[model samples]
Target: MLIKRVPSAEAPLDLLLEADPSIDTIKRYLESSICHVATIEGETVGAHVIQPIGDGVYELMNIAVAPAYQGKGIGTKLLEHAVNMSRKLGAQRLELGTGTFGYQLAFYQRAGFRVISVERDHFLTHYDEPIYENGIQHKDRLLLALEF
Candidate 1:
């Protein structure tokens, strides 16, 4: 697998959005942000967006791998790239939000993230439609951070 930065506007965004729809708005807002896609055997399988939030802080906007590719460490490699890229860019901390509970939370925890804050009822109130994954709907957002 290879992770590559894709600068074209038409670069398989549907896959990314399918992983996390909230990112569509973020992608629209951050014009100069960097986006990466992971490919295996010439197929786009995963993607993540990184946006600079000023004050030496960067946000991990979206991190997702294809359903069939989850648990195979593709997300981990992308995360490792994000961490190193942020550090190289002089970021003091990296922040992201995820469902209050689930495999994603544990994935970040395993990747050295720590809970920093929580927005109660964020997912339930912020989104117009319910966000569901594998028969589970996310009701809240938990903010996590890792300082480098």
Candidate 2:
């Protein structure tokens, strides 16, 4: 498998949806962003999108791995690649927001992201449909940051 920046993000829209459920939300972050994809034999298995916020800090806008490929280190590879890419672009830190509780929170924490703040009722205010995982509704967004 190989990981590289994708010229067009159109192809992995489906894969990206696997992580962020809303197309509107995806559009907000995807525009003018850098997109990277992991492919195995030319088939896309995962994708990560990044957008520069300011002051050498970038936002990890979106990252998604095919459901079948989750927990198999593909996401990890994508994240590691994202970090390297960030540093190459002279980034001092990377920021991302995720649910208050989920595998995603654990994953980012493991990757060195620390909780910087929380946006209360973010999902409730933004998403039309409620997002639930492990039978628990996600209402807030935990803003995580990793300073390099």
Candidate 3:
């Protein structure tokens, strides 16, 4: 797979967000952040977006892989690409949030991210509609960060 910065409109990212409903937020992030897509066999299979939040830090706004392509390490490649890009852009750290209970937390952990904090009632208090997957509503957001 090859990773590159591509126009969000040009990437097949809808497939990524549909895999996890809360990731729907990614659409808005894509509109304004530095975005990238992963291509395999010339087809977009994954995407990531990074947004600057000042203090020399960037927020990992989104990272998603096509459902059919989830286990092939495409997300990891996309993340590594984002990290390298952040360093190139002179970012001192990267931060992101994910549901308190999900594979996503572990995925970021495996990528060398460490838990920095938690928003105790983020999803429950911030979202108007309960964002759920597999019939479970997400209630908290665990913040994770990595130093560049």
Candidate 4:
């Protein structure tokens, strides 16, 4: 597998949408964010977006792996690449938002990110459609950060 930066225009939107449901939100961020892709044999299998949010902080706006490639450590590789890229770009911290509960939250925690705060009703207010996992609705957003 190869992980490399690519223009936002070249990002695999379908794969990104697997992680972030809102197309409008993704497009808005993609305008200024740096996109990276993990490919194997010239096929994109995973992707992540990182945006510098000033003050030496960067936000991991999105990350996703193709369903067929899920559970093969592709997401972890993409995340590690994002962190390294952020460090190289002088980021003092890396942050991201995810559902308050889910495999995603645990994934970040395992990667050394700690929950900084919670945005209550974030999904309820932001998403046009409700997001549910394991039969429970996601109503809050957990803001997590990894300090370098």
Candidate 5:
């Protein structure tokens, strides 16, 4: 597998939608962000996008691994790459928002993210439709950050 930086605006829509259902939301930050992709034999499998939100701080707005390759550590690799890349770019902190409960939340935690706060009813108010994983509905956005 190989990891490389790419133009965030042109990131594959299907893959982006896999992690974030709303095109509008994706468009909100992607156009101006930095994107990294994970590939195997030249086939794209996962992607992550980050954009600066403040001085020395960046927000990981999107990250996903295709269903066919979800559990193979590609997502974690991409994350590790992001962390290193962020440091190179002089970032002091990295942040992201995910559902309060889910593998995604746990994934970030395992990567050294700590809960900062919760945006109550974020999904109910922002998403056009409800998001469910493991039969559980997503209601709030769990704000997490990794401070280096």
Candidate 6:
């Protein structure tokens, strides 16, 4: 698999939507974010988006792997690449928002990110549709950060 930076316009929207459900939100961030794609045999299989939020901080806007390629460490590779890229770009820290509970929360924790705060009712207020996992609705957003 190969992971490399690509123009935001060239990012795989379908794959990205696997993580972020709102197309409007994705497009809003994509306008200023740097996108990276993971491909194998010329087929795009995973992707991540990172945006600078000023003061040497960056936000991991989205990360996703194709369903067929899930559980194969593709997401991990993409995340690691994002971290490395942020370091190279002089980022003081990397931050992201995710559901308060889920595999995704644990995934970032395993990668050294720690919970910073919680945005109550973030999903409820921001997203038009309710987000669910394991049959439970996601109502809060946990802000996590990895300090450089």
Candidate 2 lDDT at 24 equals: 79
Residue 134 error, candidate 1, Å: 5.4
Runs with alpha carbons beyond 4 Å of true place in candidate 4: none
Runs in model 2 lying further than 4 Å from the true structure: 8-11
Stretches of candidate 6 off by over 4 Å are none
Model 1 lDDT per residue over 69-123, tens place: 9879888999999998889889999999898777889999998899998898888
Q: Candidate 1, 67: how far from true, in Å?
A: 1.9
TM-score for each candidate, following the candidate numbering: 0.89, 0.96, 0.87, 0.98, 0.96, 0.99
List residue ranges in candidate 1 displaced over 4 A.
Answer: 22-26, 133-136
Model 1: lDDT of residue 122? 87
Report the lDDT tens digits of candidate 2 across residue range 32-129: 78999999898889999988999899999888999888889999999999998989998999999999997899999999999999999999999999
lDDT of 5 by residue, 1-148 (tens): 9888888666887898999999999887887899888889999999988888899999889899999999998899989988888888889999999998888888999999999999999999999999999999999998899999
lDDT at 7 for candidate 6? 98
lDDT of each: 0.83, 0.89, 0.81, 0.96, 0.90, 0.96
Sort all candidates by TM-score, best to worst: 6, 4, 5, 2, 1, 3
Candidate 3 TM-score, C-alpha based:
0.87
Cα deviation in Å at residue 55, candidate 4?
0.8
Which regions of candidate 5 are displaced past 4 Å? none
